[model samples]
Target: MSNLPQSLSLNVPFGAGPSGVVPGGAGSAPAANKDRKMASAEQLVLDLSNTELRENALLELSKKRELFQDLAPLLWNSFGTIAALLQEIVSIYPMLSPPTLNPAQSNRVCNALALLQCVASHPETRMLFLKAHIPLYLYPFLNTGSKTRPFEYLRLTSLGVIGALVKVDDTEVISFLLSTEIIPLCLRTMEMGSELSKTVATFIVQKILLDELGLDYICTTAERFFAVGRVLAHMVAVLAEQPSPRLLKHIIRCYLRLADNPRACEALRHCLPDMLRDGTFSACLREDPTTRRWLQQLLSIVGGNRVSPLQSGGGFEHMMVN
Candidate 1:
């Protein structure tokens, strides 16, 4: 399943965006000044090889947020070397192994992941990140935690970055992402991750299901179609077992996105009638009046043989007659 779908339409390559980052989006800078900035960014990336210099450079770049996006391409260029370095270090932690924080290594990779997160919103930089397999590089951070603050810092930041990656509207990005192990990884986070991890994972799940990849496309694929059902089941199960306000809110918000996505709602209708008929959904509906109303709206969107008024958000007025 490593191959992507042929239907994907990749955006125009990043080099086509702009020749240079216009400061404050004000205007283009002089050729000489642009050249100087590129030169400096290049040097800063090279300095990442030195632990002390890497920290300093990251600090400086963090202070100037726009500068980071401006330098996104340049930074992405250097990440290969950074990833190679990270790969060499992560091997010592065997499978199912808890990570013991390696301070020097953690500091370097954390900063690098942060930088990648900052640059990720750009379409071109996202393409670069995926091509570089930067997500795989960040995988080790999510699986382990440390008593050491630095290691914990890496895990938390990694969660946020993973969430941020799903914020794009690019089908090609999501298309490529589905070819990787990220979906399963997110499921794992939902199952065993910290509270914060669960929140970020929820955001990522919502974004991927509702925004990044069009629901129509996702529904056409057998695997993705089933995958979406599994996610909905897990979310409902989590809500049922240990009803927390925060988790409930995430699930509610996720469904809110689904309410507007008729294709996704249609897909859910096919799978959820069983849950609806068996009273599983009704049990959840009884949790609270406010939430019950939201669930009713969701059921209205997801009209079924039994769960009807057939008044879905997409206006299926004649559906009941059918």
Candidate 2:
């Protein structure tokens, strides 16, 4: 049950304690009273053994963006508790081990990650997750190879958090992501992860390549540009073997994003011909109009047609034939 006063407005300060003022900030009597109430409510939820109860309590609290934004220091201190609970559910143990999600623990882990994701959605609050190294805790849930019920769902949810962070347009978050191994992990998942995992990975990869904040990071240097190119090429190369229709579609969309950047386009310019010619991509082009349209656009950019639907809204959709 929430201890928040019925009259205390949700319109609290950007970083108020729980739902009030911070411990040190202008510690007025009323604000201190509110902070103590908030801390108690949080402690109550944290004490509950039922992960769902914790999720519901946190869920209700997280609805107030100010809780994360204003009380970041106080809120960030909770990340360790979150990480511990997360470890219990996924059994990844400090994130250095392979995940082995027990069926019983699956739902709880998803709920906790959902809570973490809610915090990550706030641009200012997202730094808390990164500073707490939450990604390290989150990524291993995706390791379960099973595509059936829970594991696949967990993978999708984990990827969803990363994708959401990308959209937040924060430089610190983007910088942290670029520094981590997450990019390679997403690339691998995009190529061969479970069907839904592939979809989430594709979104994250596309967001990274196309998100404006990411452009500076992705295009900072020749080697960085080339690294992006190499990763894109490798995704295409993976298509050569298994060549799932769905996977091919995701990769094609990612290329459409790639085509938007002049730097990425130039780095991938030569690879386009081989990719377009690849038996898998070519076959998909013949059968799927969406794939056909996107590939044509990518080819046109690399080939100097520079047709940009985002810019000119032109006949960029026109299909190209061999």
Candidate 3:
């Protein structure tokens, strides 16, 4: 233990027996002293200001897979210090770009973060991470267009951190991701990246759009889908080029959901020929009543009084009634 300031060692009752034992017992006092000494040793580790040491301790603790009861309580009590350390850990990202950590060290860091994320599941730590701008630290890697093995590991770690942050629902973090044009960045990344990256990006976009905050941000991304018809067309074109049945289905679903907005419906009408040709749409037409209804509504808006065969020319007219 380092030199203790007076504030850390002001207590005067040093020569006491075990807390519950009688003071006159021959060995009891020494036992109590030993316990106090052990406790003070643990406290000293907790109080250490060297973040690297603390990080190493946390890494070891995580590897042991021991109960967090002891450390969690202490971290909660000294939350300010823990938060400061987290901030410092996050700040190291700039210096550690393309992080120098080998696989083992990376695993240790990730496991430590996982444990901290569990500890920080409470509102206070969430707020602390937000206040410290932790998301900014993580976002850079997401934005990094690195393809090297080292950068790939950092990217994976960054994504894990993002998952942990969002799990906290730190609104500041959410707002930052939204406000900083992350959605568009993600979309572009998906547009240019490999199939796996695109899949992850699509999942992320859908997840964001499912949330109210994310939906609001998306709506604000373009003035209206009609006004950004070219961009919408580009998106449709990208989907049209893909062969994934599931992705096409999701894209159609998302378009249908967006079509509930009059402007989005109008913008989507321009792509109807391509959409109708998609195998997913053909599959749905055979099985999904909702798809039929959406197609009807879309045709009503796009074709006006012009009746399509399904609407008036066949037994399918009765299918809708049933």
Candidate 4:
């Protein structure tokens, strides 16, 4: 390969030397042959015409999980090629049109995508997926066929891949996803998904909302407490009604994080009573020490009083230094 550049000199003819050699240099034919062979092998790996073969290659690549560091350069080298293939597949298959992956294929793709996520150093590759408009491709599957057995399984796997991508940086592609009605779609999906799917949706939503950009968008859409109170009320009610310890902890954490903002704090206060009544708050109080501290801090922030359970004989004094 290194000698090819030298062999193909400006003086080289198309083909005029010893049997198969170029006019300008020796060994050009062998070098060109080797280069062609290498290109063919690479092309075979990326070719998507044979879905089974393409799927198998991805599966094999995924199995070599530890090699991701080594494979990073290759993935980067072929990033544009692979991204084009992915785009073509999504465009042709269209996730909405009666689904494509069988159980095995769905599992394989899910595992491969998950493994690929481990090397999400390729933000540009992720951006390619985003630019491919995968969210639009995925939204219909969330409601497909009323979430049947295998269908639901496939949907869950798809959501897992999408969720992983969203959680990567939260900034790389989320702004674009949110701009396209993905937020409301996700909220609706959370409302309708099975427990596992709901959990995934919850995590993604929390990641999105944790960022200032996402919170700003949510605030814009919801306006004030009254404007978004119904949505928050519904989310709080759902958490209260279903009562997953994991979800409860995350909800409390999100509230505490949001409470750092005065606007979010005011909005949260409107929903606090229902959240408390529904036992979401109590669930957190019982399950999370962090939540207990946050509650104490929240009390201090709101009430302007320092009542410490740890302090003994006298209340701590607040002194203003000049």
The candidate scoring highest on TM-score is 4
Compared with the true structure, what per-residue lDDT tens digits does model 1 show for residues 1-322? 1252211113322222454343333354564455455556555655555555656766555455465335666555553435534543464445215555566756655665667677676666777766766777667666664445655566667766666677866666676666776666666666656666767876677667675464554454556555655665666676565555556556665665655655556545645534433545454456577766666666667653543434333323233234
| Candidate 1 lDDT | 0.57
**Candidate 2, position 199, lDDT:** 68
- Which segments of model 3 are wrong by more than 4 Å? 1-58, 61-116, 119-124, 165-173, 188-201, 221-257, 271-277, 280-322
Off by over 4 Å in 2: 1-84, 87-100, 143-149, 211-250, 260-267, 273-295, 304-322
Best-fitting candidate, scored by lDDT:
2
> How big is the positional error of residue 278 in model 3, measured in Å on the Cα after superposition?
1.8
Model 2: what TM-score? 0.58
- List the global CA lDDT of all models: 0.57, 0.60, 0.50, 0.52
lDDT of 1 at 4: 29
Off by more than 4 A, model 1: 1-43, 59-69, 78-98, 102-107, 143-152, 211-247, 256-296, 302-322
Model 1 worst lDDT window (10 residues) = 5-14
**lDDT tens digits, residue span 118-144, model 2:** 667765577766787778776666554
**Of candidates 4 and 1, the better by lDDT:** 1
The model with the greater TM-score, 1 or 3, is: 1
Q: Let me know the TM-score candidate 1 reaches against the reference structure.
A: 0.59
Deviation (Å) of 31 in candidate 3: 23
Candidate 1 vs. truth: CA RMSD?
Answer: 10.4
lDDT of 4: 0.52
